[model samples]
Target: MILITGSTGFVGRAVVERLLAKDELQCVAVAVRRAGPKLSERVVKHVTGDLESSTDWSAALKGVSAVVHCAARVHVMEDTAANPLEAFRNVNVQGTLNLARQAAASGVQRFVFISSIKVNGEATQRGQSFMADDTPAPLDDYGVSKMEAEQGLRKVALQTGMEVVIIRPPLVYGLGVKANFAVMMHWLQRGVPLPLGSINNRRSLVSLDNLVDLLMMCLKHPAAANQTFLVSDGEDVSTTELLRRMGIALGHPARLVPLPASLLELAAAIVGKADVAQRLCGSLQVDIEKTRRLLGWTPPLTLDQGLKKAAEGL
Candidate 1:
């Protein structure tokens, strides 16, 4: 038996599905704050529990061999909480500690944490890529909290002798993905002209298919124990090229204005969108060499394949 938190989320849902596809995995249990939307029959149990509080999860974890912690307060737009950092910390940090403590008490062996590359930093420097061994210097509250959670998990591992595996995925995208990427897809579908064509910043992105594959591998892979892996689609794409490809995938000609990034940054700053501009224009890359050498695994889908898959869902 295996326990999966946030099983209804996009990545979590993919993990659950992929795990169930394996005949060797008998039971799959999920902890959800609310009654989960209907899932396939393969999901054996749905346990209702909040990360903030403890419930009787021993029944769910009785013989659970592994636990995947995927629930977190993800960064979002226009959140009006008095302290968004505290709110994020409460869930991403405190909540994760609660779950990890419980999993340890229940004798769960492997704990897989699905964290983001933001925990390392917001972006990478020109011609430099983030590596697994790099010290974490998070740029945002979300990343800070994730870093704290990783530390807490390590403490639990030290106390309980449970194996901990951390996966840092960059710009995960695919069908049913909401947020900025989805908005970009929608805008391109509507033939909106974007000035990002001139931006030469390179960003590493991961497809949901490839990310899910890595997570499944981490569940039982001997090499993944006590390791942190940086995962990507293994291809770097610039903003302009990415936008053009997205347009093609959406069956629309790329309608790019090709404005200077400096001017665009100035305009966005005047409009109180400096943060947004930086994110869109930033270059963030992750080196997946460790993942390749350690796990001997390769991402199966290419950027074009994943983009077309996402476009098909639009």
Candidate 2:
């Protein structure tokens, strides 16, 4: 039996749907927070209360052989909470450790954590791509929490012998994807002229299908045990190029206006969104060679295929 946390989330829904289609996997269980879509009898539904350090997961851990933990306090543009780092760590780090400890006690063999590439920092230097072993330089509270969670998971594995597989992914997009990707899609749909044409910046992203496929592989792959992986679509593109592609997918002209990247950054900084501008104009790439070599896996969908799917979804 496999227990999946955050089954109602964007990536989590895909993981659950993928697991449901696999007959070889005897049982699929979902840990949800509230009422949701109907589940087949084959899937056990456990209502886990608010994700916190003290939240009990014993019922969800029962009869579970493997765990796919997709729940986390994700990053947001404007954080309104008091002590955002504490809020993040309380749920993302301590809560995750608590779950892993209980899973280990329940005899769960493997624990797969879905983390973010922000653990490598927001962006990379020119011509550089983040590697799995790069010393973590997380910039924000969310990234720091994920980094701490990874370390804590490693410690738990060492103490309890529960195999821990960590996957750090770049921006993920697909059907039901939210945040920046959704905003970009909405803007494209409305045929908005974007000022990202001259901003030549490289960014790596993984599609939902490919990420879910990688997660399924890690669930039982012996080579995946106790390993950390950075995953992407194996394709890197600049902001202009990405907008052009998404525009093509949506049948919208890539109406991009040329503006100096520096000017754009300065303007965004003046508006209190230098970070968003950096994401738009900076380079953030990942090296997925290790993931490919170790897992002997390849992304099932190409960039265009994924983009087209996303467009259709929008």
Candidate 3:
């Protein structure tokens, strides 16, 4: 039996679908806040529980062979919580520990943690990419909380003899994806001339389908036990080129203004929009050679294929 937390979320749902399609695994369980629609016959049980509390999750943990934790409090616009770090810690850190401890106590064989590449921070200087063994130096509340959660999970694994596998993904996108990437897709479809042509920064991203494949491989692969993995699509794309490709996928020409990046940074700083500048001009990349050699895995879809699929759905 495999128990999956956050099974209703974007990534979690994809994992469940992939597991079901293969029909290799049986006895699926999900932990959710509230009981929603029913899943297929493959789902053996669903428990309505919140991760923030020390809820009774033993029943769900019982008889479970593996657990994949994908629940998290993602950052968003218009958030006004006082001490945002506290809010993220309450759920991402404490809540994660709670589940890991319970899973350990229940003698679960494997625990798969879905962590973000944000734990390594937004960008690396001189176009260097982050590797798996590098010491994590996160820059935000969200990244800090995830790093803390990884530490806590590692502690549990050490004491309980349970296998722990960590997967750090960068900017996952796919059909039904939301947030800033979705907004970019909307702008590309509208033929809006964005002033990001001058930004030559590169960023790495992962497709949801590709991420799901890696997760499944980690579940049973012997080399994945007690290993930390950094995964991406094995390619990098600049902000302007990314938008241009999206335009092509959407059957529209890119309308880009070749404004200097320095000027945009200056304007954003003056109007309290520095966050936008950081994201658009950020240089974040990941080295996935370890993942390829260790697990013998490769991304099933390329960036172009994934982008076209996303465009078709929109």
Which lDDT tens digits does candidate 1 get at residues 161-253?
A: 999999999999997888889999999999988888798888999999999899988988999998999999999988898999999889997
Q: List ranges where model 2 is wrong by over 4 Å.
A: none
Tens digits of per-residue lDDT for model 2, 59-105: 99999999999988899989999999999999999999999999999
Best model per lDDT: 2
Models 1 onward score TM values of: 0.96, 0.98, 0.96
| Residue-wise C-alpha lDDT for candidate 3, range 1-314, written one tens digit per residue | 88888888999988888878775676588888887777877786556477884767888887898999998887665568898899989989999888888888898999999998988887876378999988998988889999999998999999999999999999998888888888889988988889988779888899898899999999999999999999988889888888888888889878999898789989999999988897888788899989999999999999988888778767
Stretches of candidate 3 exceeding 4 Å from the true structure = none
Relative to the true structure, how large is the alpha-carbon lDDT of every model? 0.87, 0.92, 0.87
TM-score of 2: 0.98
User: Which residue pairs clash within candidate 2?
Assistant: none
Distance (Å) between predicted and true CA of 204, model 1?
Answer: 0.7
Q: By descending TM-score, how would the candidates be arranged?
A: 2, 3, 1
Q: In model 3, what lDDT does residue 111 have?
A: 94
